[model samples]
Target: MIYLAIGFPPAAKSCAYRMRETANNFVALGWDVTVLTIAEESWEREYGLDHTLSDAVDPRVRIVELPLAREDLATDIREFTEERALNPTRWSKQERERHLEHFPELVFGGWRSALEQGLLDIHREFPADLLLASCAPYVNLAAAWKLWEEHQVPYAIDFRDGWSVDVIGGGEAFTRDSEAGRWEEKVLAEAVAVWCVNDPIADFYRERYPRLAERVHVVRNGFDSDSVPAAHGAPNAEDGLTFGYLGSVNFKPEFLATVLDGWRAARERDPLLARSRFEIRGHIGAGASREANAHMALIRQAESDGVVFGGPVAKAEVAATYGRWDALVLMLVGGRFVTSGKVYEFMASGLPVVSAHEVDHDASAVLTGHPLWTGACGLDAAGLADSFVEAARMAVEATAEQRAEARAHANRFDRGLLMAPAARQLADTVRPALLTGSTQG
Candidate 1:
């Protein structure tokens, strides 16, 4: 099987975890998986690198690194043309327009030819029985389509978030008449299966393409067992409870500010919160603005309220990070559709959770049965402040049994459990076609 996982391990992106698990699970299911991703230097300019993440990948899986990188993230001035150097902003806009011409995808559509050629070369050397394309450089679909067009290789899409849905903006990203919408329609129409991270996204795709609804699957981004603490330590009330958020700070500045405002309000209202500390551990922005963006500025400004930015944590240190925190702050963006992978990890940590997102969010769906979770109440400062106070109280008064129950609620979402069966099912779906020498398309 050829897996087009552009954000595969070492990329340091949240998608990397899901990509890694997908490829590893395929290998475990007795398929020779080859992951196609951009070179390490490409990741360096984006999220830097996290070599620790590569440790979990099955040794049998082959990694094919393409010589592709995001041109916009170039930090070296020497690499830029004189025209680009003279007017970087205009150059970027022109580049985006150019990329859209080849395919509907922005930033990655230009990679269509390279990816198409790459797949053709791999197929010539070792014919592939199946192809699993993961998106976000939705350009991978172009390559998958290329292979299916030329060699009749069956393909599935790990569409973490469907391309048509504007998750952050809460609407259709593009109309069916638009180039992007047309591309998405074409790819998904022929795809053997399409997987989404949450049910809302899957439902969106189903509603959008009723004829292809049965092909859509909800695979979810589950928590890795190794990343969770073996046993959570008792909340240290003497030194004050520690609240932590461990994920990329990619939300809107206003959203983050609202969370900070709520934290401050909670601190003022509750004596326990006033004595407590809030630690944020994750990458803020990419390239020159990393750890130096408006988010960082906000976190810095909230220092007096006991907020501190601890930078990015290594995958190996995730368990230890969770172990140290008394409670977790699930600061997510979007409504209904956005169910972040952090929600699973936070719940699995067996710590009290304060949801700093919308009431209609899908994370609320996952956290509903969780005993220690302070329910979602939109991002209103007062409501979030109440949530914070409630979470602090839970952290102090909740029994270990309650924490155990909270952890148990997330057991169904263990990364391996969620992915292995999905991989096996895909393998089963393709095996008969391969055995009978029949083409899926």
Candidate 2:
């Protein structure tokens, strides 16, 4: 199997966990998986690479690193052209237009040719029976299509977030007549199976392409069992509780300010929170900004309210991080279309959760049955403050049994459990076609 997974292992992006699990699961199912991703150094300008993440990958699974890198994210002053150094925004805009000539994506379109040639070379050497493409570079679709056009290799897409649906903006990203939309339509039309992270996204694809509706499936990003704490320590009322928010700080600065305002309000009203601490852990910005972005400024400004930014945590230390925290603050963006992987990890931590996102979010749907969740409060300061106070109360008062039940609620969402079945099903579907020497499309 050829796994076109750009953010595979070592890349410290949030999507790496899902990609790693997918490739490992395929290897476990007795398939020789070759993951195609960029070199380790290529990730440095993006999120910076984490070798610890690579340690978890199955040794049997082969990885093929392409020599591709994102030019717009280049941080080295010496590497910059004079025009780019003088007016970065205009240069980036012109570069984006150039990239669109190669493919529809803005940041990753230039990688299309390298990816296509890479797949063709890999296939020439090994003769792959199947190709599984993961997106966000959505350029992987071009490569998968290239292989399918030339060699009859069946391909499936792990569309973590759907293409046409603007998850963040809450609308179609482009019209069907647009180049990007046309590319999405053409590539997805022939996909043997299309996996989406949530039902809303699957519905969008289904509604958009009714003839291919049955091919769409929902494969939620479940929490890794190893990432969840085995046991939760009793809340230390004497020293005050530790509230942690672990995940990418991808939300806007204004959104973060609202969460801080709520935290401050909660601290003022609740005596327990007065001495409590809020820790933010995860990658902040890419390239030159890194941790020196507006988000960092807002978090630093909230220091008086007991908020501290802890930077990024290693994958191996995730469980330990969860164990140390008394409760979780789930600060997310978007509405019903978004269901972040953090939601699963937070629920699995068995900690009381205070949601700082839209009331109509898909994460709200997942947290519906969770016992310790304070519920979504629509990103409003007063409402989120109430949620924080309630979560603090739950953290201090909830019994160990309640925490156990919370973990049990999330057990069904174990990464292996959620992903293995889908992986096996796709493998099974392709096995017969290979045995009979038949083409999928």
Candidate 3:
């Protein structure tokens, strides 16, 4: 199988975990999986690299790195041409227009030719029966379509979020007559299957293309068992509880301000919270603003309020980080369409969660029955302040049995358990003979 996984492993992007597990599952199904991603150095301008992430990938999987990159993310002033250096904003706008001529995606569209040719070269040498493409460099769909058009090789898409749907802003991203809409319609018309991370996204695709309704399936981004702590004890409020927010800080500056305001209010109202600490762990801004952005400034100013910024944790150390936190703060953007991968990991940690997102968010669906969740309080500072206090109460009073039950609620979201059935089903469609003798490890 040729797996078009641009952020496969070693890259610290949140999608790496899902991409790693998907490729590993194919390898386990007796398929010689080869992942195609960009060079390691390319990630330096984006999220940087986390070599620890590559440690979990199956040894049998072969990774092919292409010498492609996002030139827009280039930070070095020396790398900039005279025209770009003079007015970078205008230069970037013109570049984006040029990029759109090659493909619909702005940042990754220029990679189209390289990706298409790369797939052709790989196919001529080894001959893959199936092609599985993961999107967002949704340009991979173009390559997948290219291989299928020329060689008749079947393909599937791990379209975690549907292309036409604006998940963050909540509506259609483009009209059906738009270039991107045309591309999505054409590519998905021939796809063997389409997998979405949640039901809302899958349903959107189903409604958009009723003919492919049966092909669209919900394959939730479940938590990796290894990333969750084996156990967590009740919070020691006297010693001061620790609240953690672990994931990309991609939300808007205003959204973060509301969360910080709530945290400050909670600290003032609750004596335990005043003594406690809130640790923000994850990558902040990328490129020129990496680790230096408005988010960093807000966190820095909150130092007196017991907030510390611990930038980016390695995937291998995730379990240990969860072990140290008394509770979790699920700060996310978007409404019903968004269900972040971290929500599952946070739930699996068995820690009390204080939701700092929309009231009607998809995460609310997942955390519905979780015993330790304080529930969604919208993005209102006063509401979120109450949630923090409630989470503190739950964290301090939760018994061993309660924590165990909280973890139990998330067992259904174990990454392997969620991905294996989909992998086996897709593999069976193209290579049933291989699976007859195949046994999952």
Candidates, ranked, lDDT:
2, 3, 1
lDDT by residue for model 1 (319-428), tens: 99998899999999988889999999998999999999899888999999899998988989999999999999999898879888999999999998998888888888
RMSD of each: 1.1, 1.0, 2.9
lDDT of 3: 0.91
State every prediction's TM-score relative to the real structure: 0.98, 0.98, 0.97
Residue 378 error for model 1, in Å?
0.7
Q: Which rank order by TM-score, best down to worst? A: 2, 1, 3
Query: In model 2, how large is the Cα lDDT of residue 38?
Result: 92
**1-441 in candidate 3: lDDT tens per residue?**
899998888988999999999999989888898888889999999999999999989999989999998888898899899999999999999999888889998888888999999999888887887889998888888898889888877889999977899999887989888988888999898888899999999999999999999999999998998899978877667999999999999988999999999999999999999999999999999998898899999999999999999889999999999999999999999989999999999999999999999999999999999999999989999999999999999999999999999999999999999999999989766665334542110
Per residue, candidate 2 scores C-alpha lDDT tens digits across 1-441 of 999999887999889999989998999989998888999899998888788898989999989999889898888889889999999989999999988889988888888999999999999888899999999889889999999999989999989998889998787988999988888888888888999999999999899899889999999998988898877757779899999999988889999999999999999999999999999999999988899899998988999899998889999999999988999999899998999999999999999999999999999999998999998879899999999999999998998899999999898989989999999989987888888888764
Which residue pairs show collisions in model 1?
none
Looking at candidate 1, what is the lDDT of residue 391? 91
